[model samples]
Target: MSNSARSLPDVAYVAQPGLSGRLDWVGMDDIQAPVMLVGEDDQPMRFPARVGAFVDLARPDQRGIHMSRLYLHVDQALSTQAVKPALLRTLLDGFLASHRDLSSRALLRIRFDYLVRRRALVSDNAGWKSYPVVLTAKLEGGRFDLELGLEVLYSSTCPASAALARQLIQQRFRADFSTQDLLAREQVAEWLGSEQGICATPHSQRSSAEVKVRLREDVESLPFVDLIDCIESALQTPVQTAVKREDEQAFAGLNGGNLMFCEDAARRMQSALDRDARITDFWLRASHFESLHPHNAVAVASKGVPGGYLGGSTV
Candidate 1:
C-alpha cells in the first residue's frame, strides 16, 4: 500500500459533532499498567497497578478527547519513573498539554498493593504484609491536589466484652475458693491456669481502618510506610504476620492493654494523623467486623478543617 493510503483517519476531529454538552471527565478506567515505586529502603521495585486516566472536556463543541494520547502519556510516565508527586504532576500536565485548548483539568488514580516486611512481636522472624494503597492526583483551575488512601487491618477487642469476661472470671475464682479460709499461692496459681478457673474470654475480631489523606503540597515522596507505622502504632494491635508462642503471648497482652470500641479506634487514628505535618486533611473510617454479632460496628472521623472532609465513612 502507498504511504497516503495507509494513513488513519482522525474521526474525533474530522467527524461532524453530535454531542453539544461539556463533560466533567472523559477518558478511560481500569487501564492495566505497571508502576515503579521506591520503598523506604531506597530500593526501586515494579508492581502491577490498575490505573484510571481522564481529562475534562471543557469545550462543548468538541466531540471527544484524544483517549489514546492520555493512555500513551500514562504508559510512558508510569513505566519509566518511580511514582511520586512530581511525576504525577508532570503526567497531569502532559494530559492537559496534549489537548491544549480542549481540556483544562486532569485526574489520575493508581491502585496497587504495597508489601512491607514486618517483624514478629517477640520473635526474630519477619514476614511480608500487603496493604492496599491508592494514589490520586488531580489538576483543576491551575491547582494540583494529591490524595493518598490506604487500608490497615488490626485486631479490636471489645471493651464491654472484656469487662464482662473479667467479671465472670472473678465470680468463678470466688466460687472455686469460697470453701477455703486460707489458700496456698501454688494451688491458686494452678487453679488460675486451668480452663475451668478462667471460664470466660473476651471477644476480639479483625478490624479495618480505611484512611485517605490529602498531602501537603511541599511533600516530596509518598509516605506509605510512615503512615502505616503511625496507624499501627496508634492501634497497637496490628495483625501479626509471623508468630511464635512468645509472640502470640505478647500480642495477647497488647490486645488486653488496648481494648477499644470502634469509636475509640477512630479517635486514636484521628489523634495520630492530626500530629503529622505532611498531611493537610484526612478522613478515616474504623470498622470492626464483629465476632459476637452479625453486623459490623463502624466510626468515622476527619481532621475538621474548614471545607475539608465531611466525616463520611469512605476512602
Candidate 2:
C-alpha cells in the first residue's frame, strides 16, 4: 500500500451535536501553571498559581468550544508576560480573537499564595508571611475590569470582654491591698509587676479580613503590599510570625490598645479602603473566630457603587 493511502483516516466519524445553546462562561478551572507577577517593589516574582480561564459562548449553533485553544492561549500569555492589567487585557483580546464567532467575553482568575517578609514588632528579626491573594480580570463588550482579593490575619480583642476583665482585676486588686497599702507607690509598683496583679485577662481571637477591590483604570500594577499594609495599620494588631519576649510584649500592648468588635473591624477596613483613589469599589468581610464562643463573629461592608459589587459574592 502507498504511504499516503495508509496515513489516511476517516474524517466524518467525529462527535456531532444536533442543537447548542449560548453559554455565559465556558472554560477550565484549577489549572496549575507558573505565572510571573509584578511585586510591590516593581520586580518580577514567579509563583505557582491556580488559574481559571473562561469565555462566553455567544453562538447558539456551535456544537462545542475549542477548549484546547483556550488552554494554549492562557499558557502562552501567562508564561512569558508579567501579570498586570494591560497584559490581561491583551490576553482577553486574544481569547476573543481566537473564537471570533463563538465567544464575546473572556475572564481569568489567578489564585496564589504571596509571601511577604514581615519584621518582628520591637525586634530586629523578620520572617516570611504568606497571604492568600487572588487576581481576576474580565473583558466584556469591549470593556475590561480588574480586581484584587486578599486576606489579612490579625488579633482581635473583644472590647466588652476587656472592660469586664478590667473590672475583675480592679476588684481583685482592692481585695488584695488595704487602703494604707494603696498609698505606697513602691509597694503598688511591685504588685503591678507581679503575675497575680493581672488575675484576669481579656479574650482575644485570631481574626481575618477578606477584602476584594476593583481597581481603577489608572492603576498600572497590583498593589498587594500596599493593601496589606493599610489593613494591618488600621487593625493595629497583625499576627506575628517571628516572636521574641519583647516582640510578644509589644504585640500584647498593641492588642490592648486596639481592642475592637467585629463592627469596629469592618468599619476600620471600610474607612481605610475609602481613602485610596486607586480603588473604585470594595467588599470586605471581617471574621473573628471567637475564643469564648463556639461560633464566629462576622461583619461585612461594601461601597454602594451603583452597578458595581452588591456584596453578594466573594469573587
Name the best candidate (by lDDT): 1
What TM-score quantifies how close candidate 2 is to the native fold?
0.92
Q: What RMSD, rounded to one decimal, does every model reach?
A: 1.9, 3.3
For residues 1-315, could you state the per-residue lDDT of candidate 2 as single tens digits?
599966876332234447667889989998888889776676788989999989987877666666777888889988999887888888888888988888889999999999888999988999999999999999998888999999999999999999999998899888887555436788778888888988889999999999999999768888888999999999999999899999999999999999999999999999999999999999999999999989999999988698887753542
- Per-residue accuracy of model 1 over 192-279 as CA lDDT, tens digit each: 8999987999999999999999998878999999999999999999999999999999999999999999999999999999999999
Per-candidate TM equals: 0.96, 0.92
Go through the candidates in order and give each one's C-alpha lDDT: 0.93, 0.88
Which regions of candidate 2 deviate over 4 angstroms? 1-19, 40-42, 179-182, 311-315
Worst 10 residues of 2 by lDDT: 8-17
What lDDT is obtained when candidate 2 is compared to the true structure?
Answer: 0.88
